[model samples]
Target: MATTVRRTSITLPAAHLGEENPLPALRTPADPHQVHERDRAGLPADMARQIGYAPLRSLLPVRRLDGYDRHRTPTDLDAIVIENDRLRATVLPGLGGRVYSLVHKSTGRELLYRNPVLQPADFGLAGAWFSGGIEWNIGATGHTTLCCAPVHAARVPAPDGGEMLRLWEWERLRDLPFQVDLWLPEDAEFLLVGVRIRNPHHRPAPVYWWSNTAVTESPDTRVIVPAEEAWHFGYQRSLRRVPVPRWQGADRTYPVRGERPADYFYEVPDSARKWIAALDGEGHGLVQTSTDQLRGRKLFLWGNGPASQRWQRWLTEPGTDGYIEIQAGLARTQLEHLRMEPVSELSWLEAYGPLSTDPDAAHGTDWTAARDAVARGLEAALPRSYVEEAYRAWLASADTEPREILAAGSGWGALEVLHGRFKLPGTPFDEATLGEEQRPWVELLHNGRLPTGSLDVPPGPTLVAAHWRELLETAQADALVEYHLGVAQWHAGDRAQAVRSWERSLKAAESCWVVRCLAVADAESGHPKRAAERYLRAFALAVESGQGDTVLGALAREAVPALLAAGRAEDAETMLGALAPGVRRRGRFRLLAAQVLLALGDVSGARGVFDAGFEVDDLAEGEETLSETWFAVAERLVAGSGPVTETVRSRARAQHPVPDAYAFQPE
Candidate 1:
């Protein structure tokens, strides 16, 4: 379907942007233009001050890995400081509407040019990033880097009250030596990243450092991750792939064409295990980095943008205008992993590597490169992958059945939704498999006490559907048990019986919430539109009843889609907009808004909403999904209308359905 491309860059009217968010300043500039400049372009800088650094470029101190140097020298540092060279930097307005800047740091002999005007607010001060503010990091040892300048400058205490560096510098110091310098050629073809952390403060610093990398956001850019198994839906990584002895329900494990719109993070094997890596199609490259050594570490992946906007971008297009980023882990997840595996506390850990562009590059054009790189790099960057290798034998003792799934739905039907068909691997996960505490909830579902929200609430759908012949009599209500059996029958492709059971369950329901659960059940059962309406109702009821944030979040997820399916964008926008400011703290809201805005083809606006919302959630690869979606939307808009160029469309088309999942078929 073609779309009309509006040449007019979507802008938030003055009113849409309320008060500025209180983002901590990174460094204080002498001229203060650094702080004043921001996401938007169009400001008059004093001409004399604009070129003020030209004469004294040589005075700027050059930062090196081991120590500070006076001049840019040949070293294995991420960034080097150039002292006393004429630095020419200008922010010029571009035809595309963003402000392009040509920055010449003569001391480093680097010409860093960027369209700085198009800054996404959520691209925060972390990792080796571009397209954000200009910032650099140099540690007591290891790499130094000269990155894109930041829109805002921050303040840091001077060593001798001379001057302050950027905010990121302090953050770098606080999280000192997170990475180690790898084999960098004199010309520095690639800046090998290393990360390390030590508890410097008297109190243990709660930190989670997620490895972050951004790729050209486009539909053709597929991601390939190596794992024994992946989730049927949602972002959780499975330790072992769910084995599908038989396809059950609507869930399938392997995707047919490519990866779905997902934010899944895996728990990789330790160094002792054969290393695995994630690769992109076309065999461009693959990198493998893991915290196999780090205990308690949880991985994160997400896709979103800006705050809570009405537009939504689905990540199923083919294109190159957008970007995808991978963040290792945040302080919340990383520190816990470190705490659990104290013996693995080495500053640097090999997370993963991207495949090299050269055909003769070490790992060749195989997935093994990713794993091999991790094995080699982790000993220095991340020592944990190596240390954890010893415990592999122990974990094997406590094993459970794996889940296998495949993707069989259309893009629109699947979209941002995650489907996890919980089929037990070895043991049948029937009512018996459910824990005692969970049994009551199961009974509630069976008894029609739980609201279907948007899914058909079945008591023993899996049990009755897949292995009904193995059913045994239990000490449960006869009607409830029978209703469950019916629901299970429905799940196992017995729709007629499922419907009858649902009707019976509704008649037996004690409360209206039970009916709501039925609605949820329906939605989960593929009736998204109906599920949406029920969710809205449930949301309203929850609001009236003063339901907690969790409940509200669930309702919002349901209601938004219902509104979308009902063609209630304006209403959804209003409701979501109203709920956004208050519930902006909720990750789901941010993601939902991003989804909507992407649908509206408002990529920039969607990004703004995701950015604002991400400050609270730090959605991680969630950003990648959103970025890819925008690229897709951009392509669609360009093709249908004409606001975006053909070049943009072509690029985007090459990047659709990013390879984010891996499926291995038997030989």
Candidate 2:
């Protein structure tokens, strides 16, 4: 086939990405990878500056996505295929523009891991991420908040005058517009990707980009990068420089050799081409290379531990072969964000395809020689100069207008375009793209006031950037406006003012959403009792207003936990008991039930919850809640004989180990 772009469909056993949580996500990212003084001492000036650049305080304006369950059903998904004679690439426009598959036509080989199913897990920044495929991670240190969300996709003219698929969206985190243009030349094997992030704002913004590519994991496979040493990070909460290829007692190049999940950020020299590859025993696999702008490469190994294996299973179907990520980014580590100058932009071209080399050299004992061999193979297939030339050639056509729409994304970009009056070419966020979610903000932009009337349910997400705050400040105040303004104030770190605004909103009209936001503020500000009261009140209001089941469920999840934390065991019990059977059976609520029952001194009842096992479908990464809960229940059981102390607690924890089914913590 010549270069072609066409619509297609994929069917998989996928769980619905359920409704986004009505509750706001107010907490900051759990940044466990902070640079230590010892590690920072040897950094270069540019690296140091980028590492210390702006970091996010919270996920603000983005909502959490814990609403999904573990139910899987065969479903059809809309996909777009951009293919050439030698390679066929399938992209999922609805799922963060994820490239789901890349096939080598002549060899009948799949270059990417091609996950067997789509099972949402609590991994993305805002929640709900799945493994495998190529994920475009752009936002904070974690996976992109839009990992499970849709992005606008359209067909545009490629540099070769062939049709190319362009994926673009307005990134809410940094208030920037970005586009990913993917194309393949008629006779080319490499699928070229042109990425551009434009900052239309007057102020500078911190930008993060990581192209995460998951490849099939086999013991015979080895990852090769140009750097001799890498910044290694694991669950130990520390980063240290270590020699690559060989580490500890084993050759770390083999992903399965790792006993625990870890990140090896290759410190690729600025003089070297930015590329990474995972080659098998036969020296055949995927290779990713980009123009010099994307300077960092990483090898993320899920390890062979039970927890790692279980997580892999959780992400897809059982018996599916494992996968590891070969990633490229803008900085040395995901924890760092580069500073994009105001009114300026950053763009880079990346190519992904299969590479083959002599098996002996690829799997050689000499680390340097082994990497050199793969690099030679990559240079032969797609030379560094050729990639640079391609980048330069593609620049001219980067701004070509889209000829047809393949899929539509959220209305956020359209709203942002209206708000900023930004003149973005090539990738347009047309006013027609605006939907119900953007209607209120659209009104605010046109009428200079946020329309307010609906109080039956919770309010939609509120933008918290400085510009939106300024607009709200100038607009008239009402219950709905006040609620949104309070959220914006809260996001700006003005807790006192936020509370006052919510109070004013309450005086105007009672709103479960406003009360819930207040509860969150109080809960974090060391007013657990007040937070509990507010949560309960919010729940009551939700019920009285006949809010959606999702809203009621979300409120209960927060309220019972708050009540229990505040030592209101009876209230917590009552709230937990009042929930419908179906709601109570949700994995999150089941865990809460055990905790609430334990607090109420219903030891046997709590034990019953354990006997009737349940899974917290959205167990967060790095969370040890399952182990902690098990121990807490065990400690309560130990107290039955007599008063339990620290010694008794230790014995209880030692006596009751976390079962295999509940083991998800990195070992």
Candidate 3:
């Protein structure tokens, strides 16, 4: 049977109705081709013709495009036209260095685009595509997205009979060339942006997105974030005397510029509203967001410096650069903020930076003037409506003081020794005798610099283990100090002393089980079977105290090795399976999972986990240590299974190694 497709005839209203206009005179096939050129490089004749261009020639310029390959579509000429509902008409001035424009019939607006022509002196590679055709650049640029419209023309049904256009409504896009506008919505009380760790790969991939925002210029630029903790790594240091957070990254900064070098990585808290802000000289500023519920979030601020050399030289240089980044969820306390939430209505979490071009300028000043820009920005950028007002009020009411004080000048007198940075006054330890994995931190604290050590001190049993030698020499009367001593002793290969110290500490305070666990783990270090049992008990305590994922994650990793060594492979697998979701419930789970799988002899499975982990943990320029470690481990395992080495190697390989003296020096 033949099926007939029904076609409905639609009648058009008069051309004058609703500001509609009749189509302009159609271009006949006889019109000369429009030639718009920018930078001419890699285009070949066959490729050009298939995409509707005549042929690659000296007359046409070429251009390069930037951005991830997440939204790939065929660049077929027919596909572009059909997707945009417009024809790609060419005009004749195809000569080099000329500006070209694309006309949109519906709005009668012309979009100016650039295609640079390469001269013989210039090696023919094209530069990144500018604003006219596609959004190919990595970071945000005001001119990149001059105008935008939904790629799809379908309407989403609202609760009411009327409908609205939405990007999230559709799971996958069909159009080859579609874009959303960048301007703030009219009547917008607040503009919320949410970045998510989207895994397009079959396996889980580490997910990360550089959620860049281009702030308008302002004078007194300053930033404020509701960070209870911080981990400042990388090169440059802040000029001001403020405490920064400690994170899992490179060395801490030396105070220099008005900026602080930092990695913005963080584990998302149970509560969702972690806040960070940036303010100008006049006190007008912008704060990155959080949900109205006021859940705590992680904030990171990166500046131009040697650590971020590539970014400074390539992405965006610091001086006069305007941006403040906040990490809502993920692993490590340093590195670029990784997006870890799903897209939903009201999911923006509501954190954003608001700028003031001029604090002294009167409220009515025109937004265009350079001097009054700050004042104009506050008026144009902030939310004024009731809903926005309510949201801000809710955030203010729920905001809590941050607790993580690990930043600079967070001088932990005796505790610094616990980091394995120095020997106790009466102790016999020296740097050469320390384990390889332990030497860096110890040297760093002794020197008061990074590349030498981590900004963050080890926590949980690891911290306790690292400081045991020094603690053993302490007087028994110092209860709290003795408790930590127990922890350090356990980490330093002194089980009996660790137990004695922990028992004594507990006698002083029953709540000292936190330290006791460290002692017991140390005392039972050789007994993997016993250690696993003790670790489980400690893990339970950690969870009960609501100490957060870091503690739990540490406990899990510690036990996994012991469990595997004790031949409790099933238990280890079960343990990882049970806790993986809780620890890596955000976007960093795959990497954590890879570590677990690698211990289980599932080398292939571990590789998949690593590949997935990279989805969220993209290696920022200076973040190669962990990446290299994983790769080396994977490579070694691939070569063939062998006895595990007792020593763990440092992954911070420096082909272009900076001198020890200048490595972590502030810019």
Best by lDDT: 2
Per-residue alpha-carbon lDDT of candidate 2 for residues 1-667, written as tens digits (9 for 90 to 100): 6799999999999987889987777767666557765666577667656667787888888888878888999999999999888999999989999999999999999999999888998888888898889999898788888888899999998898888999998888878889999999988989999999999999989999999999999989899899889988885756778988788988888998999899999989989988999999999999999998899999999899999998888888889899999999999888789888899989999999999988899898988888889889898889989999989988998889999999999889989888888898898899898998789898888999987677676678888999998888888999988888988898898989999999999999988998898898899899999999999999889888988778888888878878988999898888777778888888988999888888878888988898889989888887787778888888888878587799888888788767888888753
Question: lDDT by residue for model 3 over 14-103, one digit each (tens)?
Answer: 111011011110111111112223311233333223223221111101111111111123221101111122212111111110112233
For candidate 3, report its TM-score: 0.27
Q: What is the lDDT of residue 273 in candidate 2?
A: 81
RMSD of 1: 24.1
lDDT of each: 0.33, 0.88, 0.32
Q: How accurate locally is residue 578 in candidate 1, as Cα lDDT from 0 to 100?
A: 50
Question: Against the true structure, what is each candidate's TM-score?
Answer: 0.30, 0.97, 0.27
Candidate 1 displacement at residue 68 in angstroms? 41
- Poorest lDDT segment (10 consecutive residues) of candidate 3: 16-25
What order do you get sorting by lDDT, best first? Answer: 2, 1, 3
Best by TM-score: 2
Off by over 4 Å in 1: 1-496, 510-529, 544-546, 574-582, 594-607, 610-625, 628-667
Candidate 2 runs further than 4 Å off: 31-49
